[model samples]
Target chain A: MQPLVLYVLDLAADGAFERCVRRVEARDAVLSVTDLSATRGDGVFETVVVIDGTPQALEEHLDRFARSAALLDLPEPRRDLWRHAVLTAAADLGALRPRAAIKFVLSRGDEAGDGAGTGWALGFAPSAPPAAPPAPIDVVLLDRGYRHDVAQTSPWLLQGAKTLSYAVNMAALREARRRGAQDVVFVSSDGFVLEGPTSTLIARIDGAYVTPPTDLGILPGTTQADVFAGLRAWGEQVATRRLSVPDLLGADAVWLCSSTRGAAAVRSIDGTPFTVDDALTARLRDHLDARKK
Target chain B: MQPLVLYVLDLAADGAFERCVRRVEARDAVLSVTDLSATRGDGVFETVVVIDGTPQALEEHLDRFARSAALLDLPEPRRDLWRHAVLTAAADLGALRPRAAIKFVLSRGDEAGDGAGTGWALGFAPSAPPAAPPAPIDVVLLDRGYRHDVAQTSPWLLQGAKTLSYAVNMAALREARRRGAQDVVFVSSDGFVLEGPTSTLIARIDGAYVTPPTDLGILPGTTQADVFAGLRAWGEQVATRRLSVPDLLGADAVWLCSSTRGAAAVRSIDGTPFTVDDALTARLRDHLDARKK
Candidate 1:
């Protein structure tokens, strides 16, 4: 497989998209540069879709990013500056490709570049192009073995931060890879099904679209939120609640949605294969497409 | 306050000290470069003391680093190479200053990094001296919020590895800072006092030295091990068992030992202040100095 071209950006560049590797100093001590992972993992970010020179669900993505930031106890995002940065990056990659994937990493910055403060870092990368939209993803359940209060707002140092403390997430992915699958679903020790590595799970059960409640501490995915809201305008009943792994496995249909992939249906659950229902997937894609325009 | 000079070196050089801040692109994907905090934090490292142009306890520190790596299921360290690197860095710095600090970081490489599938980074740095060792750290009781299996070694990693997953340690430091102190002693939720942020607690009670056994999953500090062994040679009955925070607070003298500062007596508990006897402290210091030589 060929390596994909990713567009990397810094959060400080105002309305400018440049292609280069630069290290932004964290506002803590010189120690901050060496110990980025030691600080609280408390910022929020988004992985977005760029297709046909258009960024899918830009507004919804930013909205959730803001929410994640708030949850992690970060300061209000400068939207005008953020919007310009995203758009500029998209525009710069315009002539090169019709479709690409972009990752927006927002980390907390130290209020000042001392060495003991906090700040956020925003990163953009172009990697794998969006998979065939509406393709179902394989779902595997793994016990994450820990629980956190998803209710109380995370400390500004912790809540919605896209921290570099991603060891557990990487462990799950490694487990999934070992199982001959591309992605895995995190199940709480108590059996609640949460989200994916970089995707959100949306289930169609009893003829309604249901997802795990955002208050459960799952990242509010920009792409999933847009798809859910768009489906609701067509009078589709969308509900948010706690879901167990068994609940997901027994669902009528399950789809993993994200800003880049848009939506991928669950092809199997714990090795049990499921038939992909084309009609429901087509409708969801159509609704998302309409919203994108 | 004086600016501190640290020596930086590569683990690959096997202790051949290169100039400080020298960058080497040895691995295609520097586990140090990739974001893999999501796997396991199972690596071991050491912070060494350099005084009068000599690395204090160089041999014993390497022995502990190697032992820690083995205990955490890491490859056997290249001791000759690693030591040479430290000595080289020491020699370079010896020319610039009479006293310095060097830290040895040994992590699992990404492919070999931690038992997980990411790379690891190992190196040394010159560090600043501590603030007169902490007049003995003011101890605090904390709950062991996570279930760590210290007894059985699963492929699962434990607290022994010096991986970048040091958020909890820093948080403990922050908590200590909140209480107007410089350090903290970790008490398991079950009431067992484990260790400190970057030091190990050794209590001198009834003329015997006691530290928690590594069977509890604490990183065996190179400096702590040497102190204990030294005390035992002088006929001090050093024992390792489950000791509570209260047990620590009420000891004759409680000391926090590390590679950097040999020993700092704990001067207070939660609210009770303890007296530090200079003769006892001097004896321990003399023992440590003789062992290093």
Candidate 2:
């Protein structure tokens, strides 16, 4: 049986995680009907990798989580309380270390209803890490229906915040699979490359690391940030810009990276194949693996 | 306590809502955390007004609900079961008749996790009907970040579907409130007047009733449709086209119409006041009120 654990949030308790329990058996009643997260999709969450009992880039993830919560105007999460819960979960699911998925979710509690905000941390046996593609993966480009500058021009769209309002993102992924593609990269209505449905895209161009700027309304990728740090430490150049599809195609090498899937070599974009550079891929992959939290 | 009713889907039972419960109490445990609706906002819902214990434009709402569910690739909702549930709820909460809100929710269920699709119908005592503004209501015009033709060109955006990913809509309303206005009328990035955050904007210009076309990526308004039918019966000219701020400002009258808020007379848009023709407002108001189911 897979190991699953849950912890109810209690910020004021001396042992914040004291209410935590192993709920691998009970499979029901985890959400109330009135929770705004369910009713209005008003919440923020993070899914992190736990490698060998250590959550990778956890502090970075939590920081982004706090930022998202703030944007949603929810109360600031007690990071220490969250930390204790994660640690307790890691200890409980210690055997699955190096591979577990640890999820931290903070929902805008039941406002104008029966409850307050709800936050929880759950851990489970991780699936095996994503494997590299046997061949170049196929991708379809989709329109995200926003200008390249909507993030600056329209804060109401909640760009750069990883809110739970991801129905469109999920639909794009499904559209990808339906078209026999493995992934998708969204472009602005103005044709600037944004980011992947759930991952960040990075292009190695002209001996420099380049990705889309956050001003384009793309999320600031935590994994991308980590990889940039590693690249800079290795004396490689890194930069951000308004990347277009042509720019990505012309790059020396391109990859999609996230917390769980360390580095994925994109095979193709909208059916256009790219030659894989073994040396560049190896270097980036090594750096990403070494930098894991 | 306010009235609340629920129905659960049962594929095994001949009557699909056989296991339904009229739980006007118990405020907890109506959902599972693994539900994609709560997790990813992957779901579709319709909010309908119940008048005299009957749901208004239910068939139209369910048809649109079906279309939205299809866009999300959700399982076809058991409409007969939902109809049964809504009728049951109306019967149970009948005392609140002529003023109740009935909600139909069809979540994409659990994906990449536990559970399956969850469909529920809930009945709640409606909040008091929207009041007549002492003066015409004030509105702030905001940009929706899509072009007028985005709805026709981009299907992946789910532009016309009433999906539960409404965080942006809610945010726009908040922005309007923050700006000291009573409502918001969203304009396309390309400067076409689209629709309100939740209501539809209809204007009277040159003795005709005109609303922005759905080609602008606006939600198809059920209430607007009803009012349009009534306007036609009354021999008033009705049309749909790309509307602009100038078109609205130059109109004889403007009103935001929805099921609960039948006619929200617009006093000012972005601080510019428009004359509210009493004749047009009264005619539309009478139609909106008489058309309720």
Candidate 3:
């Protein structure tokens, strides 16, 4: 596969939309030490999956990106510019591999700069090819340390925003590994199932695909939305509702959905195993892989 | 004053302790977009004040830095190497300015690399000279969205450690600004006074200087420790105990203590004015500025 593709978007204080993006070598240092992203993690980001030279759910990802920026009180990202950058990077990387991931970031610029923001998009193929039928993952439930209503009660906590300040998320993942699990599904302090550190929780309870409501201080999942749409098209019931740990434990099947990785079936949680439906897992993978936009 | 000074520490997996740091221009881009600090905020950091070519509380800052690293499960920082880098940057900046701030960061390295970490130190003088007797700040109390016991209940929440994932802290500062306040003091959801977004809370209650216990999931403030030392030397009572919002409102005086800025008195809380103890504030400032280590 070709090496990673990188582009730094020269964001302007006033909108200057055309021809400002510059392609750079991935190894080159493209961020200053004083950039707020590096120091404070004061930024927002989105990851889009590329399939056969097309960025899947591009507009959805951009909408969520802007929403996250608004939550952080950052300048509204110019959508057309970000779209061009994502599509261009996706095409370049997709030409090298059928499936790739592209992550775009908009930061609150350098602390020493003129208060203008910084932006960039980077695309790369996964080191290993996607596992057919999607490999099943083991997850441990971890306490997210916030009540379910935190987003509504406290906006400054930034719970619903997809921010670059993911050190806690990363630490939770590490905690999962330390517990001999592959991933984590964070549980709210009040006993509701929140989303994963980087993915959305989708559980098949009572033969209906249900994900947690976004109002519970969690991200609105882009891939989970697509999966729900596909499930509905197939005449299956889909929903957004609160799921507790017991609900998860009683589910027939469960998966963690995300942009690049699509859906990875959760095989067990906290050492409790659930019967894996291989046929349905394959069907979900097919549904995700079939996306063209 | 001279321009900013920066040094990128060449960290080795095996710990090469001698002479591996290199200075670079502060304007140069020195971090990769894929570095965990930029992407995930998966890092730890410390800031120390420099005065007259000496880094203040150097050992204390390094101790806290190592503590933060251990909390994140990062490799234990080589203190000697970090000491060398911090002192070198401090001396360079201190030569130009009587007082300057030096921040050092250690990040989990590039996602695509060999798992080696990345590190750098940047030093710069504040834009304006210190306000005489220190400026008083108005603060609004914001909900931090976690119970005070979270640090003990959930280490994964990363409370007590000063990680680079400060997006929520930055957001709180912005919220404070929107509310017409100069700063924020984040209170726990349980109604106990926690700390400031970037500083430690010190309240003079009932003739004693008190700060919240570190067990409450807040940073062990280096500057707060220095302030306590000074208070004890003056035969004033100092203690670490739990303080609630009501206790804070009824306090004789309150201050936010940090490394570079020392102690900035909180002139008011939620617009309720506090009596500024000018003599004590000046003494605290003098005590902080008098550090020679």
> Considering every candidate listed, which one attains the maximal TM-score?
3
lDDT per residue as tens, model 3, B1-293: 22389998888634554457889998799998988899998899998888888999999999999999999999999889999999888889877787888899999988887788999998987766767766799999999999999999899999999999999999999999999998999899899899998999999998999999999999999999999999999999999999999999999899999986789988999988898988888888888888798
Fnat computed for model 1:
0.06
| Model 3, span A1-293: residue lDDT tens | 22388989988733564466889997689998888899999999999888887988999999999999999999999999999889888878877777888899999998888788999998877766766766789999999999999999999999999999999999999999999999999999899999999999999988999999999999999999989998999999999999889999999888899987788889999988877878777787788878888
Tell me which of candidates 2 and 3 scores higher on lDDT.
3
For candidate 2, write residues B121-225 as lDDT tens digits.
777664454455335789999999988787777777888788777778877888898899989999888889988878998888899989998777777899889
Winning model by DockQ = 3
| Each prediction's whole-model lDDT (CA) | 0.57, 0.76, 0.89
Ranking by DockQ: 3, 2, 1
Q: After superposition, how far is residue A62 of candidate 3 from its true place, in Å?
A: 0.4
Model 1 agreement with the true structure over B121-214: per-residue lDDT tens digits: 2223334444532355566544433334433432222445444445456555665676787777776434577788688888876777788877
lDDT of 2 by residue, A157-237 (tens): 888888878898998999899999988999998889999989998888888989898888877788888888888988889
Task: Give the top-scoring candidate (lDDT).
Answer: 3
lDDT of 2 at B22: 36
lDDT of 1 by residue, A1-293 (tens): 11123333344434433322233321111122233332233234565566554667777777776776665444667665566556655664455566654445454443123333222222233434445554566667765433434234223123233444454455456567777777877764356777886678888878888888765556776668877887887888999888876677778888888765667878888887766877767777767666642
Question: Of the candidates numbered 1 and 3, which has the greater TM-score value?
Answer: 3
Name the better of 2 and 3 by TM-score.
3
Give the lowest summed-lDDT range of ten residues in model 3 chain A. Answer: A12-21
Model 2 misplaced regions, further than 4 Å: A1-3, A10-26, A125-136, A277-292, B1-3, B10-26, B96-98, B112-115, B126-136, B277-292
Colliding pairs, model 3: A56-A293, A57-A293
